[model samples]
Target: MAEPFPLAPSLWATTAPPGPETPPLTESGQADVVIVGGGFCGLSTALHLAERGIRPVVLEAREVGFGGSGRNGGQVIPGLKYDPADLVAKFGPERGERLARFAGSTADTVFDLIARHAMDVPHRRAGWIQGAHTEAGLAEVARRAEQWAGLGAPTRVLDRSETARLLGTERYLGGWLDGRGGAIQPLSYARGLARAALKAGAAIHGQTPVTGLSRSGSTWTVTTAQGARLSTERVVLCTNGYTGGLWPGLAQTVIAANSFQVATKPLSDNLRRSILPEGQVSSDTRKLLLYFRLDHTGRLLMGGRGPFREPRTPRDWAHLERIVGKLFPQLDGTAFDHRWCGRVAITQDYLPHLHEPAPGLLIDIGCQGRGVGLQSTMGRAIAQYIATGDADSLPLPLTPIAPLPMHAFHRLYVSAIIAWYRLSDGGIR
Candidate 1:
């Protein structure tokens, strides 16, 4: 028998507030909606749907938030992975403008939910900073700020002195600051969403892996590995990077890449004062970006791209230590206390993908490493669509699922893409 998904030994696992637990489904049952995966997306969808008096049964392969939702860097950044102007150009004027606004306002939705629910997480709304790795990168961020500012977003481009003051590092050329940004204890937030959903009458079953999906007349049937089954009028897949071949071509639509994270021992007050004095979460402008922030406990958390397979911790974390030394010379001797890695989905367009693959079947995947805010906002939109049956109210237009060409070569493609990004990061661009 296959083992259940293992809960990652991340800092969040030890620190997150207590979460709700549901036993595995043991017999046949029915619901108005069945949400696959118990990460932030699924929990948020359940919460929203239940608020509207819709009963949703959420099935988790392991525990809630066991995947990237709990293992992520915790930086609540707004917008898609791409720039706003590029989004406008790709999606067109009217559609693009709406997308840009949607991206910019996502963080607001996350913070509001946290406040309304009184979630027990370290929630901070100081801001999010994006540092430029080069002069050209600085210029690009300036343009990005201009484009978002035109849409009434609270975005500002920072010059070298300002960036250095905020980040306590002279390595960056410049950057931009989005005042709407913030950070949270990701696992706690995920659990909070589950609790909220439970309050609204959503049933969540853990250790319940959906093995098969089949349509029986007007309803969809979800078969569990333990032979338990669930019938529902609507089915939603929020598995994201951990998505498998349950539905034909669903997993093939996005590339799953590994992201590794490490946390340094708590810094002294003096050191903390010198580093990120404003407590803003930050990332850099690179093909494979570098993101870092200080947790509420004052530990400096850093994350970056990593190998696809299970990583050898010591060797993998050595790269991150060197990066910290380069960025903050004062942290030369800082010892890392925790290290972990998880998969994050990246779509071809570098944006979240919403698909209505079949009648009454919807799939939401592709986080692209900017999921904290985007996924929560998307969950609300999905619930609205389910309740009102209005496609126009969705955050992103639902499209038909088109499997990636040469899907079988995804592993090789990811390897090649990583090499290219490394080369570009090394100044060969």
Candidate 2:
């Protein structure tokens, strides 16, 4: 067996053993759709398809949510990773409005799923605050809030005092708040989605790695390492970051970047109250952003960009500890109980893609860092497209597959870009 990815620790390993281990495709099987990956996108698509009387078989390399879906910042934020205006500029006004509405509703879709499935993920609707690290950043947030409000979304601009009151910290200049945003225990949510999909009559096979795939006369035959195969009418690829060469062209379109997070030991009531008075998730408006929130137990969870690839040393924990202390000086001595990192799929345009490279094949990946909410919305759209073959219903624009230029040089470019952005954020531009 291949070694597991380093970023994903076994801290939140699935408590409920995966739905019995699925034997490799020794004998050929058939299904309406054969989905690859058991994360949010795959699970959500399977659940929706099952509800529509289409039972899909999901193949997983490891357990469900074993990838980035299981270990993320857990911030259920609204909107796509890119600016709506940029989307409008790329597409047009009418299509842009439609996409904007869809992006804004991503968070609502996540909450709805949690409620409908009764997923015990400790979800909350306390909203999210986009903290501004500088005055210009605060103004930019205000302008964004105004624009979103103009589009009839629930957004509010906050002043410095208001920001401090809401976040319980004076580190920020000001920011915007959207009531639709919230947080979740992501691993639990992903597992809950898997359970819900299974209850809806979808077959999820864990530890069944898809080694290869071939087109077979209007259908697809997906093969596992054990020489087992499954023929399905359609295929959906939802493997986000751990998509290690599954599809030839798929990996070229997105850059895999590492993101790290550290969780401090549960805080005392007084410290918790002094840190996050409103229990809302918060992220600063920086290129290499800092996102933090207080979990149910009042533990401060902070996450930000890690090294270009993955960190390979125990000293990475010390780096994260220093960052946490720098951000919240009051928590300098707090012991960190958990530290982990995960990969995020970033597209060239900073927007997600829902592409159909061939008939009966759908791909939904490149969520950037906004997969928590975006996955649910995109998953539903994918299910709709799979059922009706109407690509227009997708939350994002469906365009030709275009690989990023100089794909192999992404690590060097990303490193320079991140460093430049960090300097710009510090007023060095």
Candidate number achieving the greatest TM-score relative to the actual structure: 1
- How does candidate 1 fare on TM-score? 0.96
Residue pairs of candidate 2 with colliding backbone atoms: 25-228
Task: Tell me the whole-model lDDT of each prediction, alpha carbons only.
Answer: 0.87, 0.81
TM-scores of the models, in the given order?
0.96, 0.94
> Residues 1-429, candidate 2, lDDT per residue (tens digit)?
765456445334422233333434456689999999988889899999999999899998878887889888889998876567866887799888888888888899999999998877777888989999887897889887877787787889999899988887677888999888998888888888988888899988888899888897898889997777998879999998777787777888988888888888889888888876887898888888888898766788888776786776656656557767776677879998777887898888888877778778888888788898888788888888888877687866667778787888988988898777756664422
Candidate 1 residue spans exceeding 4 A from truth: 1-8, 426-429
Winner by lDDT: 1
Clashing pairs in 1: none
| 10 residues in a row with least lDDT, candidate 1 | 1-10
What local lDDT score does residue 400 receive in model 2, on the 0 to 100 scale?
Answer: 77
Residues 241-334 of candidate 1 have per-residue lDDT tens digits of 9999899988989888889888998999998998899999999888778899999989998898867666754686667777888888999898
Runs off by more than 4 Å, candidate 2: 1-11, 14-27, 420-424, 427-429
